[model samples]
Target chain A: MTYTITQISIFAENRPGRLAAIAEALESENINILAFSIAEASGFGVIRALVDDPERAFKKLSSLGYVVSTTEVIGIKMHDRPGGLREISRMLGDAGINIEYAYAYTGRPNAVLIIRVDHVDEAINAILSKGGQLIQRTELA
Target chain B: MKYLDPRIEEMPRTEIEALQFKLLKTLVYRLYSFSDFYRSRMKEHNVHPDDIRSLDDIVKLPFMYKKDLRDNYPDGMFIGGQEDLVRYHVSSGTTGKPTVVGYTHRDLENWAISVARGLTSIGLGRRDVLQVSYGYGLFTGGLGLHYGAERMGATVVPASVGNTERQIELIQDLRVTAIACTPSYMLHLSEVAEKMGVSFERDTRLRTAVLGAEPWSEKMRARIEGSTGIKAYDIYGTSELSGPLFTECSEQNGIHIWGDLAYVEVIDPETGERLGPGEKGELVITMLQKEALPMMRYRIGDITSFEDSVCGCGRSHVRISRIQGRVDDMLIIRGINVFPSQIEHALMSVPELGEHFQIVVDRKGALDTMLVRVELKSAQLFSDKLDDLIRLKNKVAHQLRNNLNVAVDVELVSPETLTRFEGKAKRVIDRRVL
Candidate 1:
């Protein structure tokens, strides 16, 4: 399956209105956000977002004075069965690629896996070579 | 480089004294309007605004201490009325109580300008991208640096702090040029960068770093600069006194104080008399041009010194040495003054211990007990050989007693036992109740 791909940009802060400015820029560019997560510390915050038009979103966010960068995260469609993640993790683990963090949500048809791995290029290549279907975030968004 | 008062920022010795005299007059006069505390204190000293005609007359005004701010609480001492205040930033409530400081729009602008000036001093320009890692909200460092970056016409990457994985990715992808954060945080970032096999120094576009808000020794500076492969400059300021109060020029000898906008004085903490050049004492500040939240003869409590010699970098403004310690945080244990920074410096000098450590002060009966809990990165610490651990403990104790003039018990905790602070870690815990 060809994954419905959407770009994810992680936003960080060194000042106020930084995240808001990033979101505003994306909205101004008419980029649709599927999901977002933020973690803050004393003087900064890390913002992660799933958005439509990943490449343009990256360029627009950067132009608007944001530390925007794209990460190739896979939206994997899996059965809502138990050990669905275990199979994926085992496959990746067997391939010697460690999963750093993963986000998941249930869809009407299937469960979505937002997987972040140690080596994005290697994991994506391995999964694709093995005929694994990578779903796009737009379908969910 | 247009200065509101060009003479002070780029002035000869003869002119600075005269400028100090004129500004002191204006400062004293200004205090009468909004600073009720200073106004009353000046009256109690039998002094009026007009009476302060010279730099020597600065003594006529009573000393303003941090306790004064703490005692006043929210808005008691502000010279400008509450209506003028655009925002208020409260100190981290680690001390007895957090002292709230108000900032007018002008004050905020001044903060941005000051930090921008600091950035410029370190060769930052419009073409550079500044990745600020200081946290925003209430704390002045992040917002203050943010405005300065924007003021300089530079692209600001407001990465507030943490989540190093993304931080590294952003650094590489965006090609950020400069970074501003605590030196410890920078070191931590460097450590993580290595583990990720990210050649931060070679690959990333970072050229300069501005580190402050916490006391760091010269040894630490060398380490930071060498490891990060960036020119690390020391920035000095406080929320109450305004952030980025001083900036180090290329010479890196001493930080140049903004003598025109803010009058700085070094005084003996005990005698309250102004000290001569090169003598260490507590730093006091007086806002000359500040309209909102102007402070008159405010004691910053930071121990420092001033040098009048022309800087090697050729900036004529008076230079302030690095802050030694805070008077309020000075722990007088068993009749000796001990600063937590001193212990931290000594501990940090030891390569075996990590950057994180804690000073726990608990009391037993009438006497106070000071215990230093340090963490080592080695998984099997104090194993196989107990002598190394004992030697480490003795070395820490000796340094504490010798440098801080206070005796403290040193304990080597496991790797993850000692507390790790996100910002301005609490170094002391006074268990005394009276």
Candidate 2:
């Protein structure tokens, strides 16, 4: 089985306190936000976050009236050095897999890269064949 | 065209005048003796009831302005008291005092009869189910069409305004054959229907529409009728003559004004001289049979030519051309009359807004959208928080809607964002393409 992580995306108006409301709901449920990024378009923003409990976060945010969706993304553990992104990107590019969007976070020893790709299964096989390490959901906990 | 009452509708031009002369003589005699408002108006113009010898002698009477309605307002212009009145419809007045129209039971009957005849001219009858989509309350459009459709024995759906998706469903589930609404609303409904994957031709059995209350183009008619495969007829009337009084017959050439109910004339707005048939000018009408609020030669500010010739549909009623434009600056938004002064009046009540505001009106997907971009007093008026801005914008928009009775989009801009004194009607930027 492939290692796929669930990322929660929240549709929010690009206004102050919107992010805080979403965060407040997650906090109330004791759901830890592992990694988060804000993608802004027009007068609104899409807030993508990786949480300790995807299902719990989805319910809490929805009940609180925040529009949220869960998407499966590949989190790759990479070298914390300068060529970490280039190496991972070039490996997928050589295999003809297109990365739609990506973001990264750093912890001790290594950086974790979260990427959304069209051909998820094929990209995972290519990266695994190249000896790259994929981050598991439990590893963050 | 079919006739609901063939005796009156299909009568010869001479007989139409005979009916008009009989009603006019009775109306003049009643007003001269009973109504101080009409008696005084006639005396000032040196005309008596005896002066009105024939239909053409209507020129001897003085013209009544919209100001007459305003000056009298609520009850002053009315012929009888509340005991004699059955209903009242109020319209927006330019000078803040709303013009109120009162109707007795007989007056309502005549209005419904007029609508019945109009519906019949357009080929809608008892078997057809009509949806009166015009607003229902104090404004006249909704109730006027409702009564007329009911009188004609058409099962009427009093689906007055808004709830586009639900109205679309009713059109399908109820098998609504005809609808009465503004031309803009028809376009909006069509656009919404398309979004819901509902085709008027396929999903619904809508065959006709009676659209009016605001000026629309023949091109707009072609656009609506051509796309939706529904026959769109132009309905014409102002609140002065009891809301929607007449509509275009099957000929679709001009809106037929029933000769028995009202006498029609086109006059040079400047000189007050009556123009011959086919001459474009202001429309003046005398409501012959109205009892509660009998209006004689009320100057309706709409600009159009008068057609006295017979319509191809075989009706001998006088027809008016499609309203070219208005001599007044009244703006009709989604069938409701909106005045620019009313916009300023709404803005004055809001403390957060500055004096300078620009009104941008545009047609989006066939529906008219009015965007009011007003300047905030200062950035310090509210924080940059999205909630605060939206709340304040909604407040301004809510104030506008409450005042004007039409939904509008409000944009909050920084002070000095609006340009000053560009031209006449600088406060408005109407980008609507006809």
Candidate 3:
């Protein structure tokens, strides 16, 4: 199995200025947001971000009284061209792996697609054994 | 360290009891001889004032209730005529007709003395400036604390509840050192002050607050003290007892009920049998010196207990624990007695939970069920993992079970969903009768 990436999920109320506050906190600590996604829940939302420094970001945000924690998610490096995305998608699909949620950000030469799947170890095997590229945590920094 | 009335306040317990019995005997004779209401109540109970030889024999007297005041209406139970009355304060009843309480010169003086002792206990003195933020008019709070603050030689600012900006102005301009208001009002004032860019710790001179009139938990007190950076002491009394009186001293353990002015007892609400010290039960009070409105063993209906041990403040008065919910708010959930205040006390202990909560009780099949729906604090205190959220729910349930001795289900709701009350917060919805 390949390696897993750490993502910070902030439990925030669905109100104005909350996202700004989170971004301001991250900026104050000089933590760069590599990639992030926001998901809406019942009257609350989660802002999952892949920052340059997950450990520092977690401590800073939590210290500012924001509900924050880190979770292990898989970031797959896929082809930059169209239909190149099919290479990793088909490998996981044919292997009977389910993609719970996925979002992509442009990396140099290729795109690093962050996908949280139900089965972590199996998804890592399905991708890595098939010669798929896995982005290291240092590569994001 | 100085007492408002040291002679009686610092007396020994035996001496305090002697004074109480003497005052009780005098009050009973006055009630039986002057008022028609007490004369018939004693006759109806077949008990005479002559039978009361000792303090413990107070049980021989019939218990008075809020109902008695309502039934008597205006001046029916008063000991003196309108010519003898100096002031009148009517309590607005939520259920029935309002209760009119008249106070003669002596009655008003005793009321102020009660407040004077209470303010002194909270570490306030003539050097401090007091803002009476309670509502004036028919409400006893404003005028009661007003007179008390004057008697204690403090500069008085009759703010009287409203105009938040002006209240803040007075607090800053007058350099008010203390305030007497309801607990909710204190929270509201702090909020308003924050909006006006005023800091309680830096801008204002408020060092202490005597908050009461509403059922507030210790956690709430901690929140107020934490937020305002002031010592928040609990002052407890009803308009029926002559406004806000008997506050927690600097120790902030319990309220010091002056043994000379009134005698307090904890009685079983169901059986009227007196419970020993430290046992939780309904509180019954007898006004030993009230002139215009002579109340004898008035059933207060507030559930609490008292300790006869002298307070650390050096007063020999009995101090009762903060008022747990009123008797009417008690619910028998799963055959276990529960009060909403107990649930509030349990929930407020967790800083993550908001002050608002709703208790919903219903019967599922043949078994009874209870559910508590609470919101998160507005600023934050949330969780991302389902397991972490579940752990919080379990912890809250455990606290509730420990306090109420009944199984309860907890649900974490979103902020701004629960209703916020300006006066009294109604937190229970029992749907079991259907």
What TM-score does model 2 achieve against the real structure? 0.72
Q: What is the total number of backbone clashes in candidate 3? A: 0
- Residues A22-132, candidate 3, lDDT per residue (tens digit)? 899999999999899987754456789999899999899767656677877888888888877888788778878887777888876468888887788888888888888
Q: Could you give candidate 2's per-residue lDDT for residues B1-434 as a string of tens digits?
A: 37998888778999889889999999999989988888999999999999889989988989998888878777888887899998989887764567789999999999999999999999999889999999999999999999999999999999999999999999999999999999999999998999999999998999999999987898898899898999999999989899999999888999999888899999999999999988999999999899999899999889999888888998888899999988877787777777788888889788877788888888887777888877666423232234455677788889887777789988765455468775664777778876
Interface alpha-carbon RMSD, every candidate: 17.4, 13.0, 4.9
Give candidate 3 misplaced runs (Cα > 4 Å). Answer: A1-141, B329-434
- The superposed Cα distance between candidate 2 and the true structure at residue B281, in angstroms, equals 1.1
- Per-residue alpha-carbon lDDT of model 1 for B263-340, expressed as tens digits? 778998888989999999998888776665667778877889999888775557778998887777765343223566
* Rank order (by TM-score, best first): 2, 3, 1
Off by over 4 Å in 2: A1-141, B351-354, B376-392, B414-416, B422-425
Go through the candidates in order and give each one's C-alpha lDDT: 0.70, 0.85, 0.82
Kindly report the docking quality category of candidate 1: incorrect
**Model 1 misplaced stretches (Cα beyond 4 Å):** A1-141, B1-8, B93-96, B330-358, B361-434
Better of 2 and 3 by TM-score: 2
RMSD (CA, Å), each prediction: 22.0, 13.7, 16.9
Candidates 2 and 3 compared: the better one by DockQ is: 3
True contacts kept of each: 0.00, 0.00, 0.20
Q: What is the interface RMSD of candidate 1, in Å?
A: 17.4
